[model samples]
Structure formats: C-alpha cells, structure tokens
Target chain A: SQQGEEDPQALSIQEGENATMNCSYKTSINNLQWYRQNSGRGLVHLILIRSNEREKHSGRLRVTLDTSKKSSSLLITASRAADTASYFCATDEAGYSTLTFGKGTMLLVSP
Target chain B: GAGVSQSPSNKVTEKGKDVELRCDPISGHTALYWYRQRLGQGLEFLIYFQGNSAPDKSGLPSDRFSAERTGESVSTLTIQRTQQEDSAVYLCASSHRAASSYEQYFGPGTRLTVT
Candidate 1:
C-alpha cells in the first residue's frame, strides 16, 4: 500500500503563476523527498526535508513539512511550461531504507 | 558525474516468457533499488541492495521475481513466466549510502509489456 497520498490529482496554471501540491502520509518518517517526472522519463530528485526541518528552498522551488500533520507541500514559483510535470512525494520510514511513494500530482503549465 | 543508467529502454514479451532488466548505478553508490510503476500509479518497491549486507527482498511480490547485484555496482531483475499484469515501468535508483534519509538518483526506466 502507498504510504503517502497527494491532493488535487491534477493542476493547470499559466506560465507565470505559482503552483502548489500537497501530500499526506500515514507513518513516522525520517525524511520526505520530492521528485519530478517528465512524461515517459526518469524521476528527477527535487528537495528533501528531514523530520526536524520545517521548510527548504532550491531555486524556484519551496517545500514544507509538517510532521504533526504528517503532510508536506511543494511550491513552484513563477512556473514555466518546462516546469510542467508530475510531482511525487516519497517517505522514508525511520528504520528502513526503502521509500514509499505517493500517487503524485500532475501539473500542467501553459505558455 | 554520470547518473544511474538502465539497459534496453523498452521490452516486449509474450505471456509466460522470461525477461531480464538491468541497472547500472552511479559510481561509488552503495545502495541500489528497484521499483515498478503502472500507468498512473505510485511507485511500488521491488528489491534493495546495500553494500555487503543481505538484500531486503520483502518487497518482491512473488517467487518468480528476483534481483541480484554485483558488489554494489550493477544489478539485474529477472521475472519468470511474465503475466500481463506484470507490464509496467521498472525503475532503478542508487544512493551514496544506505540510509532512510539519503537522496536517490534514478535512471530512465525500462518499459516492459507482456503480451
């Protein structure tokens, strides 16, 4: 079974707008990481937020984790058509090496 | 540095036939993993290999599915008697070390189709 579930299965936005996707998980985790997948391509690692961290940033991407709620969100600012892709959240259990992934959110940025 | 790589970008086989998928991890990475993804679903863990430790095969769905890694560098996943339901993208990922908090680098997966 999937340990995480993403909200708003799909999102569409104009190139310059900001897009946000949320994910909720069911178990305690050592960390949570986000990945992006272009259609038919490999997954690209995004940002990773440890259980002790609340927020992280990289370029135009921002991620937040709220352990109390077992939820996390990814924010893509000033989106571009090239930024369009499926985003997924994967949770790493405290004592395990395998990552459990969520159903992912598809973001489409229209130019 | 080059990232993870996998062979035979795509594969097609008739039901009941066997197929082999290969993965080459990034240099120096000690942790390797395999996962499966259906059309619009989340990734499903399949197997894991970390250094010299015994591999964790708990995620493999059946005895017909097995994977082997050669000293942390290359790994292969083989399925016997493929079934239509087994068709999906097989992804490989590698990390510098085996830990719950390490980030992983993924390879372009092999799309397998069982006819």
Candidate 2:
C-alpha cells in the first residue's frame, strides 16, 4: 500500500502552542495533501505540496515534504480550539488522481 | 457554485439487506470518487471515475461492493447483503480532472448503519 503512516496518533496542546504531526509513506508520489476532518464528517482540504517541492505554507499551517526520507510533517502554529480536528496526509501518484491516505493524527487544542 | 451533495444523510438497515447511496458531484466536474470511512478510521478509497474512462475498482473490498456513474453526473454505490461491518460513512468527492493540482471537493457524506 502506498498509504502514509502518521506518527503520534493523537496530540494535545494548549491554545497558544504549536502542534506538529508527521507522516511517512512507502513509495514515490506526485504530490502530498493535508486534510482536516471535524467530528468525523467530510474532510476539508488544507494544503498540497508537490514531490519536487520541499515545503509549503498556508496561513498558520506549514507543511514540509522530504521525498528522500519519504516523510512529511504538518505544523500548525498558535493553534486555537477551533483548529482541533483529525488531520490526514494523502499521497497521489504521478498520473492517477487516486490518493492513498494515512490513518490521521487526531489533535485536540485546549482553550 | 454548489459543492458535492449526498442523499439520506443517515440510513439504518437490517443485516442481509441491500443499500444504495447516492452522490451528486459538483457540476461540470469530470472526476468522481467514492470512499468509505469506519468510525475513527481514515477514508478508504472505494472507486473513482475519470471522464468516460473505465473506473478504477481496485480499492473495492469485495464483490458485494459496486458503483456506477453516468457521464460524470451522478453516481451510486450499492452494497448487497450488507453486514454490520458495512456500516460506515460513505463519502464522495469530485474534481475538474484526475491529475495535477486540482483538489477534490467532498460531499457531506451518507452515514450507513447496519443493525
């Protein structure tokens, strides 16, 4: 399976602190995307980074991809209670739209 | 500018019964995908359709699971003789194309409960 595996299945942090989640996959990929799911419902896309790129940022979110290590990390700075959600990493192959997802990292930010 | 929509936000059925879930993707989108998510689990790919091309059913768990789409408009996922394990949140997503930087737009999802 090209599915990515996220470390620290669960995380807890204070509202003002930062939270970082890591993901490691098994194969080559075209791009990696991060998604957030609230209350186990639909997932909202957060950001995407191409394999050729090393890092990306969106607002308070920072994503880094190291293909040589087959790993990626998501860092949310100054997290808020509203930012608490299950974050997932999905890897897409070169030509296909299919994405193999990781068993997300559940995050909880205390207010 | 409507997003993907699914029907019967929730459903309850008995074991051994058949259930069909519907997904209406964003208009003009050419790529559609179906996923199943068990409680507290990541989304599992079920199938995907790209334009008029043959769908990729490799992710389907069993023969009991099958899906069909008509010209990238609407798609339906049917499960025969459903079991308790079939209970899950069935999600649908759509994109303008299969590859590249296009992000998939997801539907609210249909929650299936098999008693």
Candidate 3:
C-alpha cells in the first residue's frame, strides 16, 4: 500500500491556536494533497504540494513537504470552530493516477 | 456549476442482495473516481475512469464489485451478493483532467448498510 500514515490520530485545539498534523508516506510520490471532511459530508480539497516544492500556503493553511523524509505536514493557523473535521493526506505515487489516502486526523477546534 | 452528485444518499439491503450506487460527475470533467470509506476509516480507492476507460481497477477488492462510466458523465458501481463487509460510504469524485495539480470534486456519497 502506497498509503500515507498521519500522526496524532486526533487533535484538539483552541480556536486561536494553530493545529499541525503530520503525514508520512512509504514510497516516492509525484504530489501530496490534503483534504478536509466535515462530519458526514464529502471531502473538500485543501492544498497540494509537489515533490519538488518544499512548502506552500493557502489562506491560513500552510503545507510543508520533505521528500528526503517522505513526510508532509499541514498547519492550520488560528483555527476556527468551523475547521473541526477529519483531515486526510493523499499521495499520488510517481507512476499512478490513483491517490492513496491515510487514515486521517480528526481535528476538533473549540470556540 | 454543480459539484459531483450521487443518488440514494442512504441505502439498506439484506445480505445476498445486489446493490447499485450511482454517481454523476461535474459536466465536463474527464476523470471520475470511486472510493469506499468504512466507518471511522480513510478513503479506499476502488476504481478510476479516464474518459470512460478504466486503466486501473486494481483497487477493487473482489470480482463481486464492478463499475462503469459513460463518456465523461455518469458512473454506476454495482455490488453483487452484498455482504456485511460491503457496508460502507461510497464516494465519487471527478477532476477536470487526470494526474497531479488538478483537484477532484467529490459528491456527498452513498451510505450502504447491509444487514
């Protein structure tokens, strides 16, 4: 399984604090993507970081990738209660079109 | 523009019965994908269609499961002789094009319960 594994299966943070989740993959990948799923809804794409790129930012979300370590981290700055959801890191393997997903980190941001 | 849409948001079937779940992708998206998520688990890639052609069906767990898409439009996933293990939320997503960089839009998903 080329599936990535996310550390800290669950995270609880205050509304004004930053929440960070880490993901580690087994094999080399072309790109890694982060997605958010609210309660029982579909996943919403958050950010994508390519292998060549070390870091990227969108709105209040910052993603960092380290190819040598095959690990990626997603940091949500000043999280809001609305940001409470399950966050998953998906990897697109070097030669595959399908994205392998990790178990995900269930984040709970209290307002 | 509408995002991907799926039918029968929830379903309940008895063991040994067949179930069909439907997915309607965003209008012109050329890539459609099917995934399954068991309770409290991550998404499991089942199959993907690139313009109606499924280049890889390797993620399918068994021969009892199958899916088909028609010309960048709708896709249906059928489970034959469904068992308790087949109970999961089936999710469908579509991308403007295949590969990296493009984000896939997902549907609400169909929740299946086999008893």
* TM-score winner: 1
The digit string of per-residue lDDT tens for model 2 on B1-115 reads 8889999799999999999999999999999999999988888999999999999999999999999999979999999999999999999999899774778888999999999
lDDT of 2: 0.92
Which parts of model 1 have CA positions greater than 4 angstroms off?
none
Worst 10 residues of 1 chain B by lDDT: B95-104
**Once model 2 is optimally superposed onto the true structure by TM-score, how far is the C-alpha of residue A47 displaced, in angstroms?**
0.4
Docking class of 2: medium
Deviation (Å) of A89 in candidate 1: 0.3
Q: Residue B86 error for model 1, in Å?
A: 0.6
lDDT of 1 by residue, B1-115 (tens): 8989998899999999999999999999999999999999889999999998899999999999999998978999999999999999999999988786888899999999999
Interface RMSD of 2: 1.2
| Model 3, C-alpha of A43: deviation from truth (Å) | 0.4
- Best candidate (score: lDDT): 1
Which residue pairs clash within candidate 1? Answer: none
Ranking by TM-score: 1, 3, 2
lDDT digits (tens) for residues A1-111 of candidate 2:
537889889999999999999999987889999999998888899999999899999999999999999999999999999999999999976676798888899999999
When 1 and 2 are scored with TM-score, the better candidate is 1
| Candidate 3, DockQ score (0 to 1) | 0.79
